[model samples]
Each structure stands twice: as C-alpha cells, then as structure tokens.
Target: MSDLSRLSLNQATIKYAGMEQAVSACLRAEIPGIGLWREPVAEYGLRKTGALLRQAGLTPTSMCRGGFFTSPDSDQRIKDLADNRAAVDECAELGVPELVLVSGGLPDGSRDVDGARSMVLDSLAELAPYAGERGVRLAIEPLHPMFCSDRCVVATLGQALDLASRFPAEQVGVVVDTYHIWWDPTVYQAIERAEGRISAFQVCDWITPLPAGVLLGRGMMGDGCIELRRMREAVDKAGYTGPIEVEIFNQEIWDADAMEIAELTAARYVEHVL
Candidate 1:
C-alpha cells in the first residue's frame, strides 16, 4: 500500500464537485477514504450515496456535521437537537463511524461565551448517547478563536477534548484540524491529553488577509505556515490511527478542476503532512 493510503479527501475541499465526481476523484488519485458533508449526501439521497461509496470501494471516514445547540430560544434548541438526531441517523446509514460537530456560536445579541459553551456541553450530553447507541462517534471540532462569536465557541483542542471527555471515548471525541489549532502554544500538550479521544484529524494551512467573511480563507497544505507534518505526528503520537482528512474551504481551490485538486492534495500531503 502507498503511504497516502490513510489520506482522505474531504468533500468540502472540492465543494464544486458532485458526490460521484468527488468519489471518482479520490479513486483516480488512489485515495482510500473520503470525508463527506451532509448537504450533498442528502441531495444525492443518503442511501444512494452509501451505495455509491460501497460500489466505488471508498470508506466514509467521517460525516461533515451535527451540532448547533447554542441558541437561547427553546424552540430553536429543540430544532437543533432534532436536526442533530437526524444527522446521527444519517451517519449510521452511511456507515460512517464519526460525525463531525461544529458547535454553534453564541446566540444573537448575546455576549455570553461561557453560557454558549455550557449549552454545547448540555447539547452533547443529550446527543452523545443517541449517537453512541447508533455506533456513531460525535467528533467535536474547535473552530479558531476568531470565530468564537459567529461560528464556533469551542476555540481550542483543549476545549473540544474537555467537552468530549464528558462522554465515553467511543461515543464522543475531538477533531484536531491543523488549520484551526496550529497557532496554539499548548496544542501538542492537548494532543497528548486527547490520547484516545481523537476521532478525526484534518489538515489545512492558514493564510493571511482572510476573506470578507473569513470562511473561505483556508490555504492549501504547505502554502502557509502551519507545520502539517508536525501536527500529524502529534496526532499519531496521541494513538490515533485513522484517516487524515484534507478539508480546505477556499473559493480559489473550488474553482480549480476537482481531479487536479485531488492530485495536488495528494502530493502536498506527502510533502507536508506525511
């Protein structure tokens, strides 16, 4: 097997491609697994996408998401819980062992970061058991601190691990994405602390002059200052032996040919992350 056997293409890295095309790109690039998003999977029909992965011999390493429990409104919180349950069910159907969670930010007009994080804990306390019953691990992903107010309140690997520790390791875990936590001074220590709680590991470099919304500014591997290989080694040392997913969310990368992007991603993974 090639060294890239553990490399998985995250569909968001090639958001322009359809599910079939993205899986095809992974196959053509000889990648063994894929990290899928819920939107396209639902659009293609969950059962159909599951069948496609089976036929193509592609492993669904992790599902994109299933969390947004920071809302203050009771109705909104109920809706978020319902949606996350559905996502858990879909994860079971897709045979993906892990469902990535991007816990929502503080509710509108609210400045309570601690309260929002507590909400996340409460939400996970409810959903983790449901996911565990279905054999799907909830992988809590910590977005960068810059997104603390808008995207995710969980801003560090330590925070993610702390939240995940509330549940059984098999049911809840943390995702150590290089793009988000590379700048942290205590990241390596957190990785060691995570140990068996890492469910998925994602790679994307960080770049300057973030875009208007700061959502599409992820740099491709090796294009920025993140020590991709160092982070990978840290996760490995933490006892994680799963797919290393590439999840870049940039418009320029999306504009490129999907196959080219896959090929280049493979090369970069070898150069910078292996």
Candidate 2:
C-alpha cells in the first residue's frame, strides 16, 4: 500500500454524494477508508451499506455522531441516551470501531456551560459501556469554541480527553480534528496526553469570516491558516497510526464533482498533511 493508504474521505466532505457515489469515488480515488454519517447510513440501510463497504474493501473509519446530552429537559436527555444507544448498535452492525460524539452546547436560554459539560459526563457514563459491549469505541469530538453555544460544548482536545479519561481507553477516546482545535495553544500537549485514547484524526483547513451559521465554512487543505502538517505530525507522535480523514464541509467544495473532490482531497493530503 502507498502512504496515502492512511488517507480517508469523510462523507461530509462531499455532502452532495450519495453512499453509492461516495463509495465509488473512494474506490476511484484508490482511497481505502471512509468516515460515515448516521443519517446517510440509515438512509442506505445499515446492513446493505455495511455489505457494500465490505465488498468494495472499504473500511468505515468512524461514524458521524451519537451525542446531544446537554438538554435541560429530562425527557430530551432520556431520548438522547436512547438515540445514542441505537447509534452504538448501528456502529456494531456496520463494523465501525469508532462512534464520534459531539457533546451538545448549553441548554436553551442558559449560561450554565459547566452544567452542560457535567451532563455530557453523565450521559457518557451510561452510553460508554453500552458501546463497549458492542465493540464500538465512543469518540468524544471537541468542536471549536465558536460552536460552544449551540453545537458542542467540548471545545478542546484536552476537554475531550478529560472526559474520555473517566472511562477505559478501549471504551472511550477522543477525536482530533484540526479544523476544530487548530487554534488551541495546548493541542500538542493534549495529543501527547491522549496517547492511547486517540480514536480518529480529522483534517480541514481553518478560514475566516465563517459562513452565516459557521457550519459550512471549512476551507480545503492549503486554503487556510492551519498548520496541517504540524498537526498530523503531532497526532503521529501521539501514537495514532490511523487514517487521516479529510472532513472539509465547505459548500463550494460540496458543489464540485464528487470524484474530483476525492481526487483533490487526496492530493491535498499528500501536499499539506503527509
């Protein structure tokens, strides 16, 4: 296998592509792995999707998400746990080893960030073992602080690691996404401390004047200010010898040809990440 064997395309990078299209693009690009999102997998039917991936020799590096346990509503919290449990089951069925968890931000009209974080821990305590039982590791993904108000309160790798440390390394781990945590001053140290708890490494360049809601503004590699190679080296030094998934969420990229996007992503991985 070539060095690019460690490169994977996250489905979100090409939101316009269907599962079949994405899989075909990955095969066309000679990419070995992919990161899947829950909705698409469900839409494609879990068993069928798993079979397709296996037949094509494609590995599902990780699943998109299985968390949102920051709601102050008791019923909502219960429902969130139930949904996460189902996500864990899907991970097992799809043979995915990692299920990324994006801890939701503060509750509606609330300033209690601490309370929200505590709820994440509480939810994990219940879901971690449930996931572990099915041989799936729950990966806590810390989004950028800009998303701390509505998306994910876990805004740093250290915060993710701190939460993951509460459980066994095999049952819980942290996702190191450069797009999310690149500006963090202590990211390298956190990577080192995450030694055995690094579950997935996602890459995307950071750009300014983020789009309206700031959800679809990620720049392609080499188009922004993040030190991509430096971050890759840090994750490598931390003993994470897994796929470096390119997870750009830019609308412009999404509107491009899916196959071309895959090819460009691979080339960018070579130029900026490897």
Candidate 3:
C-alpha cells in the first residue's frame, strides 16, 4: 500500500460519516492520520473529540479552515477575527497544528479584487500573532480561480506565499492542495518558494464536467487528470514532510459506504500519490 502511514482521510471525503464513524473508518483501514473540520468537531464536542482521537491512535493532521477575511464591513471583520481566534484555540486543544484558510471573495456588490486582497492581508495581520501565541499556524489556501468570486480571492500559490511572507513563518503559512494548484504553470517554482511556509500538503483529483456547487466536485486520487505524484514530490522537494490529506468533496463518494470509501482512498493514494 506504499506505506499508508502518512495518509490522512479528511472528514469531508466521507461527508456522511460523523466524527466517531470517520475515526472507525480510519482505524479499519489502518490509516494513521485524519484531517478534521470545525463543524463535526463541535458536534462531537471538542474535549471528547480530542479524547477519541487520542484513544484511537489517529493523528489530527490539520483543521479544514479559519478564514473568510475579505469583509468590507468593520463589524463583520471583527466577528470573523474572533471566530478565527476560537478556531485557533480549537486547533490547540485538538492537537492540530495547521489551520487552513480560504480568503473570502468580494463583499456584497464589490468588485475590487485588489481591495478584497488587501482586506485579507490586514485581517491576517490581526490574527497571525494570536494564532502564533496558541502554537497554531494559519495556512493560507488559495482556491482555484473558479472559486475566486465567492469562496477565495487568492488564486495562485505565489499569491498565497506573498500573503504568508508578510508574517513570521511560524505564524502564517500556506496549504498546497493538488486539485487547486496542479493546473498552475509555475506551481513547482511556487512550491520551491514555499519551502518553510508549506504548512499542509493536501491531495485530491480534479474531475471533469464539474458538478453543481463545484465545491463538491473533487475526485478520488486517480479518478481525474491531476498529477498527484508530481505534486507530492514537489512539496516534498520543498521540505514539507507532513501528513498527506485526501480532502475530496464529492456527493457520489459521500453516498458510498464510509469504510469502503476509505479503503479505496488509501489504495488509490498508494497507486497515485506515492
């Protein structure tokens, strides 16, 4: 299985499974790691989630998100920053070190991409020290350009790195998700530039004929066109030796048997990512 030791099944990959069920699936597959999300963690109870992962011997890789820092309203910005601080506290309690961030897109009726990006930077400047104090790193994850309008504004790895470079590497970093950046022509160079800033290395394929709500269109490791292994090698070459999370978001996979999906994910990861 090409050493499934470093493989992590992100909870979103099996969206139907609750936290306990997800842990059980990981155990059955002998997967050593798991990437947790905030909602499920809250549902399971933070202290209880920590206890369960510790008991099950599964490592908490990274948290799903802690951003949305593109608000133009000062009140909304305050709320977002508070929520992020809580997210950082949650990560510290759960023993997860990386908190992935998706920079929010334009505010209502606003089209200034440059201005939205500036808001992201300013918000990060406010949260970075708070996160660093809690021993958590804010990993800026630039979504694909398709998501630039609503979900994220940082569209490239270089751009994500530019934002990360503004803060201490221990405080702010970047997530290199294969499905999002594999199509970028200068991805390798960006990875090189991201040496110390690569906080998380996520893997998932990009499927064709994207489903509605494109957020759920991610494919299994070998099911699409992304060069999973090359991306892995590039991240490795950049010195990020952390858990490789399989964070796919697809309705079909979510509807399948959780354990079987996990097994298939592991096998495909071995075949395609390693």
- Prediction RMSDs, each to the true structure: 1.0, 1.1, 0.8
| Candidate 1: tens digits of C-alpha lDDT, residues 1-274 | 3498899999999998999999999999989999999999989999999999999999999998888889999998999999999999999998999999999998999999999999999999999999999999999999999989988999999999889988999999999999899999999999999999999999999988888858898989988999888889998998999999999999999999999999999989898898
- For each candidate in turn, the TM-score is 0.98, 0.98, 0.98
TM-score (C-alpha, index-matched) for candidate 3: 0.98
Cα lDDT of model 2 by residue, 213-268, tens digit: 58888999999999999999998998999888999888899999999999888888
What clash count goes with each model?
Answer: 0, 0, 0
User: In model 2, where do residues sit more than 4 Å from their true spots?
Assistant: none
Per-model C-alpha lDDT, please?
Answer: 0.93, 0.93, 0.93
lDDT, candidate 3, 50-73, per-residue tens: 999999999999998889998887
Steric clash pairs (candidate 1): none
Superposed Cα deviation of residue 89, candidate 2 (Å) = 0.4
**Segments in model 1 whose C-alpha atoms lie over 4 Å from true places:** none
